[model samples]
Target: MYALKEREMIFVFTGPHGAGRKTVAEMSGSTLGMKQVISYTTRPPKATEVDGQDYHFISPAQFVAAQADNEFIEVSTVNEHLYGIKSADIELMFQQSGSIYLILNRFGAQTLKKLYGEHVVQIFIYADRATLEERMRESGDSEELIAKYLSHYEDEMAYRDQCDHVFENVDLAHTVFDLTKTLDQNLNRNLLDLD
Candidate 1:
């Protein structure tokens, strides 16, 4: 519940799991004066994640009800956990901050791009397979879950061609800097092109 402001663009960061998409999105959003759309999930919070701020952690029934009500802009199941963005949350983010940054899987990103057209800027983040496997292990993902993620690697790579920008998230600081610069340029370009 926030007052309406100027409409804002939507930035969707998509890539393989453990590629630091969320980290880069958080850095970019905070540095650029934009807000992030805290998604809704049926999964429990990680040790470091705050409840309402990071995601609206909910029960399976609650998530299913929302889905039935068509509350989500996009939804995807990963490792048996459901992740989605609520339309209400998005509207609130736009009202409060004029723009939103979000992390999503390849399918979710593509859905958002198709739905929002020019208002959506898609960025694909990836890392070497070895790095990805190591990060996933460090993040506590099980062997099965890691395998599931690996299965999606080909699709994630193919979707990169559809994105507006792509980067390998090797160095966090460098990735943040590069993403910030590219985002600033695109936002400025959009502003000037709005004849």
Candidate 2:
């Protein structure tokens, strides 16, 4: 296993679909001086989403070629669609000063944790079933899909123990403040603090 140097920190944000991962990522990136790492997806862009900004929308053939070339740091299938984070994008971000944050799903987070180990600061965002359902409803998700998501909520919650931080995103402003404080305290401590 490769041990992490004190200077390196990789922040990972993960949660269920309606739990506000992307929103938190955007807000946190703006506040933390960290760039939001855009991921590639085979799924078509949503009506409100812009190409490259929301995701690097690509054809399945292109995705497969990238995978074959070992270009992705992590990849996974979600709701019958494929998503991946390019390895070069992460490496390039780390090449700059300050920390890098990647917003990903549980499977991708687990894969990155295995690859990066101590260099990573994994965070799991969560909310109660009612809160999640309400958020999903507001997003216009179908009841059947919301029910399916709720059915898997318990299993998802169980994975929280695997993360370095488990944040309850009940209040967006408060949660962002709390997360910023935690990152500053844990990852921005003095050099000797790692000892």
User: Pick by TM-score: which candidate is best?
Assistant: 1
lDDT of 1 by residue, 1-195 (tens): 222343578899999888999899989888888888877899888777899887889999999999999988789997789998888888877877767888888888988887788888999999988899999899888898788888888878888899999999999999998888899887774333222
Candidate 1, clashing residue pairs? none
Taking all chains together, each candidate's TM-score versus the true structure is 0.88, 0.87
TM-score of 2: 0.87
lDDT of 2 at 109: 87
* Backbone clash total, candidate 1: 0
Model 1 TM-score?
0.88
Residue 121 lDDT (model 1): 92
Model 1: lDDT equals 0.85
Q: State the lDDT at 58 in candidate 1.
A: 97
183 in model 2: Cα distance from truth in Å?
0.7
Best by lDDT: 1
